[model samples]
Target: MIKNANIGVVLVTFNRLEKLKKTLESYAEQTLYPQYIIVVNNASNDGTTDFLAEWENEASPYKRIVINLSHNLGGSGGYYAGEKEAIKLSASWIMVADDDAYPSADYIEGMDSFIQSYIGGRLAAVCGSVVEKGSYALWHRRFKRKGFSLEYSEVTRPEDYQKKDFEVSYISYVGPVMNKVALQEVGLVDKDFFIWNDDIEHMQRLGKYGKMFCVPRYELHHDVDSQNSALSWKSYYGLRNNLVLLKRYFPLRFLIVLSLLTAKAILCPLKGKCLQEMRLRLTAIKDGLVGNLGIHPVYKPGWSLKKSV
Candidate 1:
């Protein structure tokens, strides 16, 4: 571990108290613990606030800090808020994680070692491999090289990363370690995105300043299958934000590839699947056309309890 580096781990959560607890448990067992742990509670009504307070009171190793927002800020907002706090704390490196991802005991140690070795002044951010919890299948894949096209391919196990440091188009924010200096140079995640594609957008900006690396040896366990599942609003933002990203950074050839992919999604063969995809695509396009990128909040039934403990 880099003893000189003050690393802060930031976790963003909504109502997944149980998953957050699991993530914390894994963090508590880390071989190379962060200087501090910050949890951004996004207006959760599911006893999340009380649970955080309780966890803070009974912490084992790392310093526990919680910042409760008055309303839901979505993933992008939560990450931006956490990153801002991390910068305020003067952390050299900030590790961003989802509430459901659990890193192994040596995960941070591996990341620190990798960063110390390959990350000259040119390295801005480092991303780790994310493996599914149950099936152990690939969830997150390696990042595309600077001039390469973006593709979602399966990553193999035993998690050995490519050695050389290279410029990447984007890296997964699920378990990415960001350099504060780079963030200050490029700016934090775009709050306009609200959620989807925010990480990609941030990485794209950071690439202008320095290189982004993927440390596959440092792996995390994500409890969900990110590849297959797609929430309605997530799909909408993804399609819209991808368009925005493509328009901003992608080359003309890649733009054509993206358009083809979008067309395929809109014109899939199966009736049910095609209609659903088309609806999401159309809604996203409509929202983009009218400058309505923000999505309406959807609360679960009976979610407005006065107090949860």
Candidate 2:
């Protein structure tokens, strides 16, 4: 261990018992174990509780804190809750990852060393490199500016990141180690963003506080087979949150993004997998433009977002 590194690793999970187990197993094998493992369970009806009961009871080298919520708080809310708990632990560093993010055994070691190497550097966080499980392709390792807004660089090659470290405009939630100093400086993660784009919004805000860098030397496996826009509810939240983030961080680019949304809405039906997906996108854009956010009926049967709101 790195002598009281005090790195707290937070995870937000729901209805992903098996995936969560694998992720925890990976952490258990880490060469440099985190001081704390904080997991925010988003009201999972699955056997996650029972699994965790057994898992946490096993011998471990660190503290395991599990927060079971009363209801499903979505990704953003779960992360916020977990991060808050990690912060309360007075950890010097905090690293949050999704349930499916499986890091290499040396990932924690590499990150600990990287932070130690940059004792006097202005680093907001160190985002680890993530590769798609099946394709083995690097997931947008670079964050950058697009037309009036932010965008990710194209799928990168492994050799592209041969450098020890490189600066980035944003950090993904796949796996990013953050120092308490930077966390307090940037502020808490926004809970309003119930799902997608929450990480992007937080990263944008965080970039203003300090610099972000990608450490490809640290490896991660993001078990994402594909990103099909056909998932109505997923696409809905994604676009909705994307618009909300764009407006929050890049108001000048609001119209630019809005214009693009309009185009997508108009042509989506023709190119999209089905009319349902197109409609979801349209509804997302409308709600986004009107600043409307809440639980929607599409996610639950016979229920409406208004009820939750």
Candidate 3:
């Protein structure tokens, strides 16, 4: 509806070609089409690159480009790569999505309308509501603090969301559209994060420029499982990165918080006998405190790391 709104989308994915295909289909089905779509593939070995090459050969309506990464640099690095491509494309506003988020037909229209709103001028980033495709449940989680530690217990809805926009401290990397102006002022995402806490750090930067909002009226189908996989090992990065963030940004509170978390790492597992909260978790805490980062080569037995495309 808005003329000459060159909305460029940056999609980051790895090893989820089927999900990526569905997302591409969903993007193609949008009522308001993007000017271009820049996909950042983090060296997927699942025929993802070949599949996208095939997509390019099809009679696709919108312009599409793919940036094939050399390594599995995780989501943050993937997003950083996409942001660079978006800037080069001279996008008016950049929309970001993970492979699993499937935007509705009016997704871009809603984003455009949100950007055209009165407070839109100050909105650094805007995100849409996401519902779990299988459970039909709200996707974001409600977090609470229990003195130096945090807990994720309840479902989070936009409490102040009337029929439209509402404030949010954080939003999942499901479907976030950011104003290029704000991005120019705030700068790009932290690639050092490599995955978790990258969005949080990026949002924290945006706060210095303007606020982030969620327009809960617009919805998307997010079909990923809510809980962590039983054999998953991503917790290493998640835990290490957040602790590293706290140490870097919250210097004065870091030691006390770290001490508390270290105690929790030792004492909590003893109480629950959880293997996930094992000695390896303490190793992560140590790794975070010492500032060691990047793709961890240490994987469990039975798993292999395909480092590149």
Candidate 4:
């Protein structure tokens, strides 16, 4: 609806080629198309690179910029790179999404409408309602901050969210449309985070500038499992990054969180895969405390340095 609005869409992906394809199709179906679609491929070995190459070569209505990294930078690094590029393109607003997440047909249109109407330099960012599977996924919620320790509360009743836009203290990477000026002031995402909690840190930065809102009219479908099992590589990054954030924000609370994680690691089952997970958790705690970041060699997705019994 808004003419010549440079809305850049940045999508970060790794190994999820099928989901990425569906996401791209969703983008194509948008009522209001973005000026640029920037896809940051994190060196996925699962034919993702080949697929992107073909997609980029194909004819499209809008411009497609694909950046294939030599190594996997994880979500944090990937988003940093993509958003930086979006800023360089002189995008007035930037929208970010994961490969497994996509917006509804009028998603971008609604975001632009809000930007043109309600956002008169008062709002830093705006996110849409995220629906996973068939039900309302309360991935976007308010985060209560206490001495740098962050906790979020979900809406028990999804029907409570009316058509009106609500203020949010926290914003995730899923389908958030960010203003360029706010991004320039806050700077890019912390690539050092490597994975989890980067969005929270970015949300904190944006909160310094202006208020962020969640417009329920714009919907996005996120294909993600809300639960994480006990044994997972994600445990390492989540625990480590959470500790890093705690230490950076509140040093006193850091020790308290560290002690709890240490106890969990020690009390974990001592045999089989649980033992492996325990070892990884302990390593994460150490890394978080010492400010050791970047992708862990031993603890990674799909592959890990498993110890023998």
TM-scores for all candidates: the values are: 0.79, 0.87, 0.84, 0.90
User: All models: lDDT?
Assistant: 0.72, 0.77, 0.73, 0.82
Q: What tens-digit string does per-residue lDDT give for candidate 2 at 1-309?
A: 334355889999999888999999999888888888988888888999877777667777888888998988788889999888887886788999999989999888888888778865587888678878544445545556465663533445567578777777766788988867877888878886678777878877777777777777677888775664335456677788888877776777777888888787778657844555566778888888888875665653223333433
TM-score of 4: 0.90
RMSD of each: 5.7, 4.0, 4.5, 2.7
| Residue 93 error, candidate 3, Å | 0.9
Per TM-score, the best of the predicted structures is 4
Ranking by TM-score: 4, 2, 3, 1
Candidate 1 segments whose C-alpha is farther than 4 A from its true place: 1-5, 59-61, 134-139, 145-169, 225-231, 251-279, 289-291, 297-309
User: Residues 1-309, candidate 3, lDDT per residue (tens digit)?
Assistant: 323345789999889888999999998888888888889989889999999887766776567898999987788889989998788777688998889889888898888877776454477778778778544344352222333322322345546444566666555567878878878887888786777778766766676777777777777788786674543356667778778777766665667767876887788656965655565568778888999877666732223222210
Question: Candidate 3: what lDDT?
Answer: 0.73
Quote the lDDT for 253 in model 1. 40
User: How far does residue 53 in candidate 1 sit from its true spot (Å)?
Assistant: 1.4
Error of 2 at 253 (Å): 2.5
Best by lDDT: 4
**Weakest 10 consecutive residues, lDDT, candidate 2?**
300-309
Candidate 1 local lDDT, 176-294, one digit each (tens): 88888988988998876777778877877887888776666567888874453544456667667766666566656446756675676667545455455565566665454445655
Question: What does the lDDT read for residue 246 in candidate 4?
Answer: 79
